[model samples]
Target: MADTLQAGDAAPDFKLPRDGEGFLTLADFKGKKLVLYFYPKDDTSGCTAEAIAFNGLTGDFAAAGTAIVGASPDPVKKHDKFRQKYELSFPLLADESKQMLEAYGVWVEKSMYGRKYMGVERTTFLIGADGRVARTWRKVKVPGHAEEVLAAARQL
Candidate 1:
């Protein structure tokens, strides 16, 4: 895996398809803090819950000048459906080629039921306005995660 990013490290740049048929890049969030989260799938239980949690706090995040974005291997079509189903307010980035995932070191070998496979590690990064990573949370637990991220973003 590429060296995992840490606080003080420059956030990697990316241009990815979003749910509504446009691209999102780090530069798009220039001059604003960002909450970038990576999940393994679009409609799974944990993913859904996390998306909803973030959506519920969209106003709070905006108040803090932080933009929330979610990225998954799913295509834009699936992302659209998921967002509509949950009424998600933030953009869901489609990283179909897994390029951004690898760059962020969120793609990893995961084990479940004694089987090992490659998947997203359920990670979140809080990037400050200057494009440096402010904090990172790996192996994220869905419950109350958005709240935790918000707390961290507020500090930034």
Candidate 2:
């Protein structure tokens, strides 16, 4: 397990494959505020809603000079499908090895139906232009979460 990052700490750097074309590195986002979100899976109900809500607010995020990036343990193919299905404007990173998820402290043991399994926990990190965590939402509730992230991005 990786150490949990706290607000005001430097966001961890990662390089992961995007849904299309090529890979994206944290360095590429320098000089811009970033909304880095981690979700459990692709095309699931809550995940779908969260992605769509973010997609719906892409313009607002752009107006604030912020970029959004979603990450999951799913493969690049899955990300491609999810992006295409939702018309998401941002890149969905493929973290097949779960390294990035663990680094972000979003990968953990989760319980459902009396069974526990390791998975990505819903979380979001608002990274400032300076590359530090400006805000963080852990165990996030998907409903209205994108709007809350937008508000934080605006403040950044």
Candidate 3:
């Protein structure tokens, strides 16, 4: 596996299908900060809360010139339903092949109840306008995370 990315590393490039029937890529946010969050699945409690929190802060994030996007290995159909169910304000990219998740170093072996398996780690990357990572949160705890990322973007 590649070493975990740090604040100064160049963010990996990705182009994936999104919930809104369009594709988004790293270059799309070239001149703005981006919050790229990777989660395990859609509609789960933690994931739902995280999405809603970010959705609620769309205006605040836009004011800071930041864009928010979520990603998961779930298919595009799943993403669409999850977004519509929660009325999510941002796009959720479907990484069915797990390439983007692996490139970001979030796809890994996980242990649950003493059993090990591979899954997506809850992680978030704050990519600066220069295409370098400005911050990263690994093993993320959802509460107040969106606000924290927003604060950082405002600082940027």
Candidate 4:
């Protein structure tokens, strides 16, 4: 695994498929704050709740000059369905190759029922317009996480 990124490190750049069509790149968020969240799967209970919470504060985030994006190993088709079902107002990135997830150090070993597996660490990064990470939340809990991220983005 790559070194875990910390605040003040240059945010890694990436371009990945997004829901609907076309792609989203780190450059797309240049000159603006970005809330990039990595979750384990699409449409799962925790992931869905996190997406909805972020979606619920879309206007506030926009007002703060921030953009919210959720990424997972799921493909574009799955992302589309998830977005539609939740009425998400932001982009859901498809990181099927796990490149972005690894680059950001959110891909790691996880254990459940005493069995180990590789999966996303449910992390969130607040990146400033200058491309530096302003804050990071690892092992994120879904409850009030979007609001927490929004508060950090406002600081950026």
Candidate 5:
């Protein structure tokens, strides 16, 4: 397993395909606060709810000088469907190789009903304008998560 990232650590760089087309990188969010969240899959119950919560707060996040981006191992096509289905206001990154997920320490071994496998850990990283992680929420529960993240980002 990879060492978990913490506040003050430098956020990892990634060049990933996004929902519509083109790519986004960590540098794209430089000099701005960012909510970089990693989820298990697109269109899943928890993931959809989380995305909607964030989407609902998009204007608020922007007012706080923060940008929100979501990442998952699902492909760009899936991301497109998911984003359209929810009318998500932010970009959803595709990490099909799981490389970015591992670098962020979100890809991990999970067990459900005694079936063990690798998947995203439902994590969120609040990165400051300096590119250092300001806060990290691991094993995140969906309920009120976006509001919590917005509060934290506002503090930053």
Candidate 6:
């Protein structure tokens, strides 16, 4: 596992494919605050709830000048279907190689039913306009999480 990034550290730059489209890079939102979240998979229970919560609050995030983006190891095809299913208004970056997930320290050793596997840890990072991490939530719980992120973004 890589060292987990802390608040105030420079956010890593990445170029990943958007859902059924071209690539998106960190620099693409350089002038705006970014809510970058990492999840295990598309259409899963926890992941779906988290994405839907953020989707419901898309306008509030926009009003706060923050752009929301989700990342997962799923392919662009899966992302496209997930977005369409949830009506998510934000881009879901396809990190098929787990590059961005590892960089963000969300990819981890997870145990379920006594089986060990590697997957995303349900994390979120609030990045400031200057590209520094302003806040990070590891092992995130879906309920009311987006609201908490919005509150944090307002402070930034």
Clashes (candidate 1): 0
Q: Give TM-scores for every candidate, taking all chains together and pairing residue i with residue i.
A: 0.97, 0.97, 0.97, 0.97, 0.97, 0.97
As for lDDT, the candidate ahead, 4 or 6, is 6
Show the colliding residue pairs in model 4: none
**Over 4 Å off in model 2, which ranges?**
1-3
Best by lDDT: 1
Score candidate 4 by TM-score against the native.
0.97
Instruction: Report the error of model 6 at residue 45, Å.
Output: 1.1
| Candidate 6 residue pairs that clash | none
What's the TM for model 6? Answer: 0.97
Task: Note the Cα lDDT for every prediction shown.
Answer: 0.94, 0.92, 0.93, 0.92, 0.93, 0.93
Local accuracy of candidate 3 as per-residue lDDT tens digits, 1-156: 334789999999999999969899999999999999999999999999999999999999999999999999999999999999999989999998989998999999999899999999999999999999999999999999989999999998
Q: In model 1, state the lDDT of residue 29.
A: 94
Candidate 5 regions off by >4 Å? none
Q: Count steric clashes of candidate 5.
A: 0
RMSD of each: 0.9, 1.1, 1.0, 1.0, 1.0, 1.0
Please rank every candidate by lDDT, starting with the best: 1, 3, 5, 6, 2, 4
Candidate 5: tens digits of C-alpha lDDT, residues 1-156: 345677888888899999999999999988999999999989889999999999999999999999999999999999999999888989999999999999988888999999999989999999999999999999999999999999998988
Candidate 6: clashing residue pairs, number:
0
